[model samples]
Every structure is written in C-alpha cells, then in structure tokens.
Target chain A: MKKFLSLHSLLSLICLLLVANNIKYLFVFIMSRQKVLNEVYYEPGYQFHTFLPHLKGVEKAGYITDLSVNRESNDGAYLQAQYYLAPTILELEDINYPYFIIDSKNTDFIIRTIKETKARRLANNEYGQALMKRPAP
Target chain B: MITIGYFLSFLLGRLTLDRCLKENVRLLHPCAAALLALVSGLGLSALLTFLTFVVLDSFHRPVIILVNISAIIIFLFFNRNLYIQKTIIPITDWLPWTKFRWFHFLYILLGVFIVGVAYVIALTHPYGEWDAWAIWNLKTRFLIVSDSWNLIFTDLHYHTHPDYPLLLPFINTWIYCFSADNLHPIPMVTNIIFVIGCGGFLCCTLYQIRKFSFPFLMGLIMFTTPSYLYLGTFQYADSLIAFFLLINLYFITMFQKTKDASWLNILGLSLGLTAFVKNEGLLMALILMFVVSVYILIDKNNRVGKSAVKHLLFTFLITFIPVLIFKVFIAPPNDDILPNINTSNFTAERFQILYNAVITEIFHEKWCYMWIVVLALLISRIWRAFNRENIILSIFFIIYSSAIVCIYVLNGKADLSWWLETSLSRILFSLLPALVFFGVHLHYSKQRGAHV
Candidate 1:
C-alpha cells in the first residue's frame, strides 16, 4: 500500500491524466495541419502575398479595413497583411500615404474609401483586397 | 545555408562554453554542456550579428558571417588545449542506459510523442500566431528589407512595439543573412530548437543534480503542459525567455551547491542574455541579480564572498552591453508604460481584478491542472518550499509577479481586461517551467534531506 501511494505513483497518475487531457490537441493538430499548411487557415492574409511585387520599393502605405482593430479577427488580418507586404509600412485608417491597402469584405466600403481618399486603385487581388495610390497634395 | 548558420551557432556556443567553464568541463554532464552551448552560442551569434549591423550601419551578410567566424576562431584558439585534453565527449556516453527501468522507457516514449506534437503544431502554423507575424517576424522583415535597422523604431511603426528588445528579430535576421529571401521556416525551426533546448536542459540538469525519477517527471510535465507547447510553437519570445530563465535558475542552483565562482559568472552571463529576450526578461534579470547579490552578501553560512558578486555583475554587464546600446541609443521610448504611469491608477479595485485574473489563470484548463498539482505539493509541505536554495527562486517569483501586477495596475493606456486576456496567459506560461523546476527541487530536497 505504501508503495502504491508513493510520490512517484502520484506523479505518474498526474502525468497520465495530463497526457489523456491533452491528447485532443494532437488530434486537433492532425485535423488542422493540412488546412494550415495549404494556407487555407490563413487565406485572408495568404491572398495578399501576390501584392508583394506591386509593393516593392514602396516605403509606406495606408491600410483600410471594415472590421475595427479592437476585434481579434481584424487585428490578425491587418498584421498578417503587414507581414506579407513588409518593407512597405501599413498605416491603419490613414490614407495620406502614396499607397494604401484595402482589406475588407465589404465591397462598397472599399470603393467608398478609395473614392473619398482620392486614391486610384493600383492593384487588387480580386478577393476584396487592393492597393491604391493617393494623389499627391 | 540555414543549416550552415545553425552549425556555426552550435560551434560558437560549444567552444565558448568550453572556454568559460574550462576548469569545470569534466564536472558538467556532457548533455547539459551541449544544451548550454547551443543556447549561449545562439545568443552570442545574435549579439555579434547585432554588433555587425551597428558597425556597418546596415545588414551585410558577409560581414555578419565574418564576425561569427571570427568569434568561433577566437574561442577555438582559446579552447585548443582543452580539446587536445579530450575533455568533451559524446552525449550518448554520459548516461548508463543499460540500467534503465520500464518507467524510464515510458517517460522516453512520452517525451518523444510530446516533441512530435510540438513540431507538428509548429509546422501547422508555419507563419506562427498573430504576434509572431505582427511583431517579431514583422520586425525581422523590416530589418531585412530596409537599408537602416532604425526603420522598426520609426514613429510610424510604434504599434509594432518599437521599444521592445530585438533579440528574437535579430536571431531571425542572422538566419536570413544566409538566404536570399525571408523564409518562414527559419523562425519556426528556431522556436522548435528553443523548445527542445528548454526541455532538454531541464531534464539534464535534474539528472545531474539528483539521479532519479524527478527529472523525467519534471520534463514530462513541462512538455505535456498544453499551453507551453502552444506558446512555444507560436514562435513568441516567451519561449526564449523561459529557456533563459531556466538556464539562470540552473546556474544559481549549481552555484549554491558547488560555490564555484565560475558558476556565478555563467549565471551572470545567462542573466545578461535574459535581458535581451524581452522587456519582461529585463525586469526578471534585474530582480534575479538583486536577489542573488543579496544572498551572496548576507548568507553567512555559504561564504560565497564579495568577489563572487563582482564576477557575476561584470560578466552580466559585459554580455549586457549590446542590450544597453540597443535600449539607450536605438530603441525609442516605451509609450505603453512610461507615459501612462500615474499613481492614481493604483486602486483597490485594480488589485482585486489582478487577483481574480491570476487565480482564474492558475486553474485554467489550458494548463491541464499542472499548476493545481504544483500548488497542492507546495501547500502540503509549505515549510520545505523555502529552503536556502528555493528561497532565491521563491523571492524572485514573488517580486517578479508583484512587478507585473504593478505594471498592469499603473498603466492606464491599455484596457485592463483586454490586456490581461491577451497577455496574462503567456506571462504565466513563461513562469510555468521555472515553477515546475522549483517544485521538483523542493520535493527532492525534502526527500533527500535538503542536500539539493
């Protein structure tokens, strides 16, 4: 009985429970690995990779998104876009830069933002994302 | 090319470790030495690469490689005689595997599965979670593309946390030096290495100190903690900080046992490297240095002496030179905490909120009841939790947690709930491994009559 109730036995029990509890994470990984590897999990930002060529030599750009930055989803998209199109700084909500990125599901919002900012659309990934150039003041 | 970069880093680390602990080389378990070498070597390489960027005023791959090679050459030259003496041996020979029991084999199997899961998670999120792409890897991208390293600190990029330390980004940038384009796998692989290194270091150190089952259990608990694996693969600097903190604790424990000044010096170096991982790491390093210094000064029984403090401080300051330069000269002011500090921000309600959040996080299912077990163990033997060796860790943990609370309370800029919800888990995650290590030591010290 003492051997059965030893510290090692107790710790082993805890370890066993821990492994049993976390086994779902492994299955979760297996289920999601293909989607993530295929960039389906990150498709919103993955779509912006094509804009890299257009963004070359661009120092700074403006960013406009329909979703508020406070939401986790919006922040993820904004940051991922920034990551994919780096070297070209993405200033959120300010369209005063030479170039700006439009990341939003709302088609009218993108059109209105570009039209109101007096920016011409330079490139668009055809998936509700675009790069626009603002007219110099 | 990336392999070459990692090889250079490992060689630099191995050689430097040999030189730093030449007299004590044989005293160290070969596995532990190799783990320390890898981490320290990666750190030194990052520092050297940062220095090269500063001197050249740009990211020059050739110069970066040249500087690293030069450092390796210097260490090799110094360690030439030690190598000739055949002091270093293969890690496989360090342990007597013939005497292994079934439980040991079970632990090994579990360890392998945990590591495999971690790698799969890393591969699944090749771009890492939000912070990895947004802050760390984003900064690396800017450094690679821009002519000036100061681009990350520009007023326009303040949202990227311009004031945060650049150790992670710099390490990624060093790997990027050998490639034509920014590869996503570099940071992924780097994070994996750090994760493995942290677990490996913990197990090997425990094996060295107390050749028993506790080491394997501590390691299993570390890897099996769901949040630890996720955060590690998330490619955040938290894992790096965790590794450095564990390294610091190991050095401290060794110093206490051996009373060797070299251990103290290595501890100093590790603390200095810790300062570069993140702002929280800087705070941790300062707190640890103070606690250890006080212990050295006041502990009459240990008799570590005054000179030992100087050795620690000097080595720490020497390795900390790059961090000092980066913080003072390059990085801009921290807008989050510094400007937002107000004494009026402190209140009873804030403390209540913090207390509630901490308690909630402690029992959160993400940790898989790991902390619950640790808390039970500590409470069951509360007195044994604060021995001479554990006191350093205990005091450090208390002060660091208090400091974190103060920072949250004093900063009115970020919404308290939002801030806590986003960051509190990762902060606790970073402390998890150290806490586990402390608990294992506490248990072993009690069982073995406090020798540990």
Candidate 2:
C-alpha cells in the first residue's frame, strides 16, 4: 500500500489515466477525418486559387461579400480569401479599386455589388465566387 | 529541400552552442544541448533572414541560403575543436538505469503516443486554425510573394496584427527560401517540431537536474494536456513563446544553482528571443529581467557579481537588436492595443468580469487538472512556495499575470468577454509548461534535496 502511494506510483496512475482519456479522443479525431473542419473554412480559399492567374500584376483588389465584415463568422472566409490571393491585397468593401473579388452566396448580391461598383465580372470559380474588373473611367 | 534547410539551421545552432559553451563539463548535457540548438538555430536563421530582407529589400532565396551556409561554415570551423575533444557524454550515462523498469517503458510508450497524436492533428489541419492563415502564415505569404514586404505593416493589413513580432513568420519564410512554392506543410511541420521540442526539452532539462522518475512524469503531464497539443499544432506563436519561456526558466534555475555567468548570458539570449515571439513575450522578458535582477542584487549568498549581471544585460541587449529594429522601423503601430489604450474601462465590474474569466480558465477542462495539481501543491507547501530558489518564478508569475490583467482591463477597444474568450486561453496556454515546471521543481525541492 505504501509503495502504491509513493510519488512515482501516484504520478504514474495520473499519467495512465490521462493517456487513456486522450486515446478516446484520438480515435474519435481520426475516425472523423477532422480535415472537414479545415475544408469548410478553406473551400472558399481553394476556389479562389483558380482566379490567381487573373489577379496577376493586380497589386490590390476590393472584396465584396454579403457576410458582415469584422465579425467572427465572416473573418474565416474573408481571411482565407485574403490569404489564398496574397501579394494582392483585398480591401474589404472598398470598390474604389480597379479590381474586385466577389465572395457571396446570393446571386443577386454578387451581381448587384458588381453593377453598383461599375465593375464587370471577369472570372469566377462556379461556387458563387468571382473576380471582377473595373475599366478605366 | 525544406528538410535540408531545417537540418542546416539545426547544425548551425548546435555548432554555435558548442562554440559558446566550449567543453564546459557542468553546463552541457547532450539532450538539453540538442534541444537548445534546434530552437536557437531556427531563431538565428530567422534573424538572419530578417537581416537579408533589410539589406536586399527582398527575400532573395539564393542569397539567404548562401548566407546561412556561410555562417554554418564559420561555426563549423570554430566548433572543430569540440569535435576533436569528444565532449558531450550520452544522457544514459547520467541515468541510474542498471535494469529496465516497467515505468520507463510506459513513459516511452506515452511519449510516442502523444507525438503520434500531434502529427495526426497537424496533418488534418495543415493550414492550421484561423489565426495561422489570417495572421502568421499570411505574413509569411507577404514576406515571400510581395515586392514590398514592408506593405504588411501598412494600415491595410491591420486585421493581420501587423504590430505583432515576426519570428515565427520569418522562420517559415526562411524555410520557404529553400522551396520554389509556399508549401502548406512548412508551418505545420515547424509547429510540430516546437511542440515535440518543448516536451523533449522539459524532459531533458529535468532529467539533467533530477534524473529519471520526476522528469518522465513532468513530460507526461505536459503531453497529456489536450490544449497544449492542439494549440501547438494550430501553428500559432504561443508554442514558441512556451518553448522560449521554458528555456529562460531552465537557464535561470541553472544560473541560480551554479552562479555561472555563461548560464546568465544564455538566459539573456533566450529572454531576448522570447520578446521576439509576441508582445506578451516582450512583457515577460521585462518581468523576468526585473525579477532576476532583483534576485541577483539581493541574493543572500553574494556569489553573482556585478560583472555577471553586466554579461546578462549585455547579451540580452545584443540579441534584442533585431527586435528593436523590427519594432521601431518595420512594424506599424499596434491598432488593437496601443493606439486604443484607455483607462475608462477599468471599472470594478470589469475587474470582476476579468477575475471570473481567469478563475474559470484555471479550472477549464482543457488543462486536464494540471492547474489543480499545481494549486494543490502550492496550498500544501504555502510556506516553501516563496523560498529563495522559487521566489523569482513566484514574482514573475504575479507581476506578469497582473500586467496581462491590466492590458485587458485598461483597453477600451474590443468587448471584454470576447477578448478574454479569444485570448485568455492562449495566454494561459503559453505559460502552462513553465508553470508545471515550477510546480514540479517546487514540490521536489521541498520533498528532496534542492536539485531543481
């Protein structure tokens, strides 16, 4: 009993229990193929990758989205878009720029934003995301 | 190619440490030295990369590689004597393992299991959590792809925390200097190394001081914490801060024991690196410097002389040069923090909210009762908690925690609960390993002879 209660034994027991607890989560994490969590947030960015060629030499572009800016719910998609299309700064809601990246689920909202900003849709990935160009005035 | 870059960096670090220590029998332990080399090498590489950017106005990959290779050649030549002398005995020689214990096997198995879990997580979340893409890796992308890397500090990228230090991104940028493309795996791999490095370093340092059982236990305790592994793989700078903090604490403990000026110099360098990891690290470096300076001055045993203190401060300032240049010249003013500072929010109610949030986090399930164990240990030995050996750490925790609280309390921007919810866990997470080390050291110091 004394041996069992020794510092080594007690610490070992705690560690054993902790490891056992962690194994349960490990199995769950593996089986779930938790890559989906990343894919959900990253899909919009991945879709934007095809538009990178169109954005060449374009140093900065305005970003238009139906999602609320600066909110937590909107940050992931917005930031991911900004990350995927880098060296090309995505100025949120500033349509004064000559180029724009449209990320919105609503078809009307995308068309309206492009039309309102006097920009024409130049390229897009079919999942309701696109790149728009504004001709010189 | 990235692997080759990382290896060269590691070699650079090992050779640098070997040259600096120079066959100091009491100071060099193979495992501890190896761990220190990995971090220091990577950090030095990052600093060199930053300097290259400053000089060339771009991240010229070939030049970066050539520079690192040149530095490595210089270190190799200087460290040749170390190779010839055959110093650095194997860690097993210091251990008392005449016969294999079942406990040793169990510990090894646990270590392997933890590392496997970390790798699995890293592979799944290759881009890492939101901040990695938003802030850290985002900066790395700019550092690589942008014609003007200075643009990252402009108001345009404020959401990306432009004011934050650039050590992690610079390290990733250094790795990318080897590859033609910015691979997703680079940051993921880098973070995993830090995670494993922290655990390995903690285990080795403890083993070097108080061998075998307690060291393994501390390693297991660290590995078992779910958040430590999860946040580590998230590719954030918190893990880097934790690693540097552990290094600082280890060297501080060593300096306290041996009064070796070399250890004090290493502590200064480590603390300087800590400041480069994040703003919190800068705060920590200040607090640690103040506490350690006070300890040195008031030490009952007048072993540490003024010359030793000068060495410590000198090394700290020298390593801190890059951080100074980056902060003053490159990075823009912090929008979220410094510019928005206000004392109007420091009400009794705000303090109450902050207090509740901290207490809740202390008992959060993510910690796996580790904090509870620390609390229990403290309560059990309240008297010895502030002994000469432990008081520096005790003071650091108090002052640092209070400073963090003041940041939250005084800041007018960002909702109080929202800020705490987003950040408090990570702030605590960064300190968790060092906190555990202190707890174990305190317990063992009281129970046994003061080896730690």
Candidate 3:
C-alpha cells in the first residue's frame, strides 16, 4: 500500500524527466543528424558589407535605390571580417539590413571594384544616369 | 561547471512535494496541463535545433533544448497536481476551437488591437538599426549560405559578433530550415512575434500580479517608449532579452507564492536564455545572483543564504554553459575579448580586468549612465519599501536589476562604452513585469478589477 507516492517515487519521477529530456540531446549527437536548408551562392564581388564584402556593384545599386538589407542581401557586417576594419556606417531605415563596412583596400579597392559583375548589373539597370556616377579617381 | 543534470537534480530536490493547490478546488485538469506543456516544449525545442542545423548546416548541442523540455515537464507535473488548478496555461491553451465567451472576447480584443498595430509596421517596414543589418542579418545570411552549421565556431569571421547569443539565429534558422528558403522572412516574423509576445506577456503579468483592471499609466509608458517601439521593429536582441527578463521576473514572483522550487530553476533558466540572447541581461542576471545571495544571507537568519548559495552556483553553471564553451574553445584568442567574464579562465589577472572595466565605466559615465539612474531609483525605493517593512520585494528588485548592470559594467572596457550607452537604458523593457509589480498597488479589499 505504501509502495507509491513516497519521496523516492518523486525523486524517481524527476530522474525520469531528466532522462527523457536527455534523449533528444543524445540523439542529436549520436545520430549525427544532417539537414540541408537552402543553397547560398557567394561569388567574390565588391559589395560594401561590414559583415561580408560583396562585389561593390551590388552595393551601389541598392545605395542608389535605397533597398533594405534583406532585399539587397549584402547588408550585414561580416562577424569577424578583418577586411572591414573601419567603423561601419550603421543605418536604421531597415532592420533586416542596416549598414555596410568599407573594405580595407581604401582608394585602390574602390577603383579596382568598377569591373565587378554585380556592379555591371547595377550600371545596366540604372534608371539611366550611368555617366552621372562619379569617376573612381 | 554544473551540467544540466545537476541543475535538474537541484530543482528536483526542491520541487513542491505536497499537491497543495490542486488538493480540493479544481477548474482544469493537471494531466492535461502537463500534456500541453510537454508537447509545445518538445516541439519548440526540436524545432529550434532542427532550424539551427538547417540554417547553419550543422547540428548544435541539444543541451539547452533538452533542459527546457525537462524543466517544463517537471514544472507542469508539479504545477498541475498541486498548485492553482488552472489547467490551461493560456499561452498555448487549446480553447481557440471553442466559441468565445464575453471574457474571452475581451482578451482577444486587447491582444489583437495592440499586437496587430505592431505587426503591421513590422510587415511593411525594414528594421531601423544598423546593428540588425551588420550583425544579426549578416550572421543569418552566412548560416543560410554555409554548408554545415558547426563551422560557425571554427569560421570566426563568419559571425557578426561572436559574443552575441545564438537564440536569435536559431529562431530564424528554424523558419529557414523548414521552408528551404535562405532569404530571411523568419527573423522578420520572429521580431514581430517577439514584440507582440513581450506586450502580451507584460499585460498579463501586470494584471495577474497586481489583480487590477487594464494598465493605463504604466502600460502606456512601456508601449510608447521610443526605444521600446523603435527596437521592437528592429532585428536586434536587446528588445527580445528585455521580454525574456520580464517573463523571468514574473515566473519568480509566481514561484514565491507556490513555494515551488521548479520556479527558481525556471527563473534561473530564463536568465540563462536571456543572457544567451544578449550580453546585457546576462550581465544583470550574474550581478543579481551575487547581490541577492548576499542580501539573502543578511536577512531571515540565513534562510536566503543556503538557497542563494545553491541557486547562485546552479545559475552560474547552467545559464552560462554556452558562453563558457564559446570562450573556452570556440572564440578564437582575441586579446580584445573580455577574459574575466568567462569562468573557465577566471584568472586573477583577468578577474581584475573585469573588475576594473565595471567600476571605470560606472563612476566615469555621466548622468546618462543607466545603472546610476536605475540603481539610484532602485536603492531609494528599496530603502523606503524596507522601512515600510516590504522586505522580500525590495531585496528581490535590488539583486535582479543591479546584478545585470554591475556585472556587465565591470566586464566592459572603453570600447564597450558605445555598446552600453546604446543598450542599458533602452533595455528597460526587460523590467516591464517587475515594474508592473513595483507600481502595482491593488489590495484584496479593493474589488478585483478596481484600480487605485
């Protein structure tokens, strides 16, 4: 009659919960669960992201058009990118994407960046005024 | 470091033994409550990990998930059988299928009217802060593009701030993983939900703790604070941490009434999660753990001392494990990293640095400093409340609020000043529930819905 509802039973119950929770934790480790979500293509471009340097062309298109970070993709400061050593210009208009860090190569990096593929895309899609763009010099 | 096992052991040891609340009066079923909590907790936990792997392309350690699931299950088990017979915890209640009564209609109206307004803004606009773009979204993008998630640790440059918590990423990852879409609709949605949830939780907590009609002065103060509204729509973790901190405080207060040990564990757990969400709350929680424990020792003939000691140890070990692991092996040796904050390497040299960092910032910062103002307000209120003999509540506020401020300020350096200035004051949203308690002045003699 006294076999149940004792402190021991309660303790045992806790142990059970601890063990039950442990199951998922263990499965994730032992099973080596592998899952695939999306395909992300990152080609070298001069996109001025403080998080990751995108091809500069992609950045200019958005800057001219004033697109949000997520919409433009080249937004975040690369978490620990040594390339973006300068202070990033933080923006608030958009939450998902805010600011881009200037690349480290200074004037030369900016000048050499005119030939980027994404840059050409921006140049072609200009609501015209491609020549209005300032010379790299 | 205390493993999840030890934390569980401590909570289990302290779990409410008697079925006091559920003994006679009954409205809902306990088993039903446990079932509801278990399913949601498990699903959410699994979903977090599943999403993390999907987004980052690697499996994260399931320790926190499992711990949460365990805590929820145990709490539901004890909570249902003994305490307040309210089986439907309402947050995940199953009554959506039922036709609404007038009271239910009122609840719906309130939740929808305010949250709906917030959601509309989130849908149409982009986040406002540069941090959201430069850091949170940047990391999200990398995780989306990456082949495996585990590389996040090895690929240090892949992150925005290595010190930032993983919860936000996991949240976004969960959505991305299922839809198989890299572009982030999930984080935006999460930011929206987090804001709405914070508002909803605050309303409920204010009403429950004070037993009053809808809040007007305090609620408006909270809802319209510039940063409250501004950051809510942004993608940063500060607002989210504030929400978690408020909920954690609520849980602690409720736990006191029940004498349920699980509440303490849950409280500690929430702080840990909050810390994992943002460095600000983590810093606060750490300081409070120390101050509150010491305060407890000074009062009630050492009653608080033992409990405080146990809880402090457990809280430190359980809540800080991820950070510890990150600092120990994950975070590459950057001389810039705050060494004293990490327990695994709490050398005297580093500890002194941590101590210096905290003091220099606090004493040197002008009136704009958050800790100074909040601490001043908190101290006076504490003294007045104590004189009025409101001992327990005073101690509680001091330890909880001051802990985050003191610890983080101590750990921070001059470079971290911007981080502190931009955050601590704005993060007051985290104190919503606690603020509700402080301002709450209703009494049983006053009618249930009556305001002061």
Cα lDDT tens digits, model 1, B1-452, are 78788888888887766666666655665566777777888888888888987887678888889999998898778767765665453333325465477876765676577678788777777778778887898888777777777778873355578899988888888888777754677999899888877877777666655554545555666666667777888889998998999888877877877787888877888888899999999999999999999999898876668878998998899879889999999988788887998889899998888889889998887777778877765666568757886789889988998888889998888778778888998897788778777777776654543334
**lDDT tens digits, residue span B34-74, model 3:** 32222223223423453335444553335434544565576
Ranking by DockQ: 1, 2, 3
- lDDT per residue for candidate 3 within A32-53, as digits (tens), equals 4222112232321213332233
Error of 3 at B140 (Å): 2.6
**Among all candidates shown, the one with the greatest TM-score:** 2
Estimate candidate 1's alpha-carbon lDDT, on a 0 to 1 scale: 0.78
Model 2 misplaced stretches (Cα beyond 4 Å): A1-12, A23-44, A71-73, A105-112, B24-29, B85-110, B208-215, B446-451
Interface RMSD for all numbered candidates: 3.4, 3.1, 18.8
| Residue-by-residue lDDT tens digits, candidate 2, A44-127 | 278788778988888888887787766343556668878888888989877788888887889788767767877877888776
DockQ of 2: 0.47
